[model samples]
Target: MTRWTQAAVLARMRQEIEASAPDPGDRLPTERALAAAIGCSRQTLRAALARLEAEGEIWRRHGQGTFRGRAPLGHPVRETVRLQAATPEQLMQARLLIEPAIAAEAARRASRSDAQYLLRLVEDGRVATSRGGAEEADARFHRGVAEVAANPILIGLLDHLADARRRAAWQREWDRTYRRIGVGEFVGLHSDQHQSVVTGIAEGNADVAEQAMRAHLLTIATAMRRGSDPADPGL
Candidate 1:
């Protein structure tokens, strides 16, 4: 019998599914059965499944079991999905590395029009009535700052990072965070953070913009990590 590590288990599971070639909506075995067959604990199996879901290889409905996903994209950029099987902390780290520099560049290069557009997004976020509305405004604000940087490569990288945010796991994190912190409070905190970032950019202060962007992301990342179980490797 072969000892199965997490990566090996994940790979083998993918291979099994591909070889079976289930129809698009076909359901897989129950999690327990799958774990037993794969020679992994249920916890390990769940992590592998989550990664596959993130990669668009499968989809899971809450009450229903997992089902086969649409065919993978033929675009060469499928590599991006494979490279980004990141936890919440890892995604936050990537943003911390990427956004601060974009903020600084936007400060230097942003036109008055760019500043106004960002300010509008900040205001939109502040007044947003629902969580989804606020999240969209926040995304637009960050992506707008990246746009102001006028570097297509940076813009594309940020676009990929933003796409990662739409993953089901990240939504679970936000929902968990909201349950821990009241929804109103969560929205208010994010609004204030967005305001600070907009102010820094409007002032055309690169250092200040970078600092604000870093601080904003750090605050959310810390809150998210705190809300998560310390022992959960999936986090």
Candidate 2:
């Protein structure tokens, strides 16, 4: 029997992911099955999966199985697949309009438990070591705030916005920008802003929540602008 090196195992697993050709939101098979199919131990398979996730080749939800590609910021990629693609500015503008209001409403309506949940999301963002992990927390934080507002209409709308982030063109642009801006710095800045938003919501100050969220979005806009000139036809 051949002793499979971890690097070799990882290469094989990646080939499988490509061969399977799962859509962005499609979940891969269980570890046991994948390991069996690849003739590797579960521990080896998990390591390969972790590397794939860190490289933004795949994502994992807390309860959901591992998904095939980078998770979108706002909505499931499947939801946005049929919708018309949005420009980066359009996506940012939509968030500016919707998210601040959601934060304000959450401040007014959130119970103590709800505030705790939001804080937990903040902590998740702070501790995230990979771009995909930070992004997952970011998406869940926004969705969590919307959920706290108890507005289904806004929730559905936000999902569309989230899904837009997963567009191949959009992700490529974001990736290019982040490569220029430094992913670690970007994640750190985002984590700080996340804490502010949570604090504003937990304090039940609608104005504070609105301002915090607006400021946070503006900071992100600034980073995006710094990374890519919106007027560039190539973008």
TM match of model 1 to true structure = 0.68
TM-score of each: 0.68, 0.62
1-235: candidate 2 lDDT, tens digit per residue: 3568988988888888776644464557778788988998888788888899999998766544666777655445444433323467778898999899999999999999999998888888878887888788889999999999999998988887876777654576678677665657546777788778878888999999999999999987776776677564331
RMSD (Cα, Å) for all candidates, in order, is: 9.3, 12.6
Relative to the true structure, candidate 2 has a C-alpha RMSD (angstroms) of: 12.6
Model 2 misplaced regions, further than 4 Å:
1-83, 230-235
State each model's CA lDDT, in order: 0.75, 0.78
Give the count of colliding residue pairs in each prediction.
0, 3
Residue 169 in model 1: shift from native, Å? 2.2
**Poorest lDDT segment (10 consecutive residues) of candidate 1:** 75-84
Candidate 1 residue-wise lDDT at 145? 87
Q: Which portions of model 1 miss their true places by more than 4 Å? A: 1-71, 74-78, 230-235
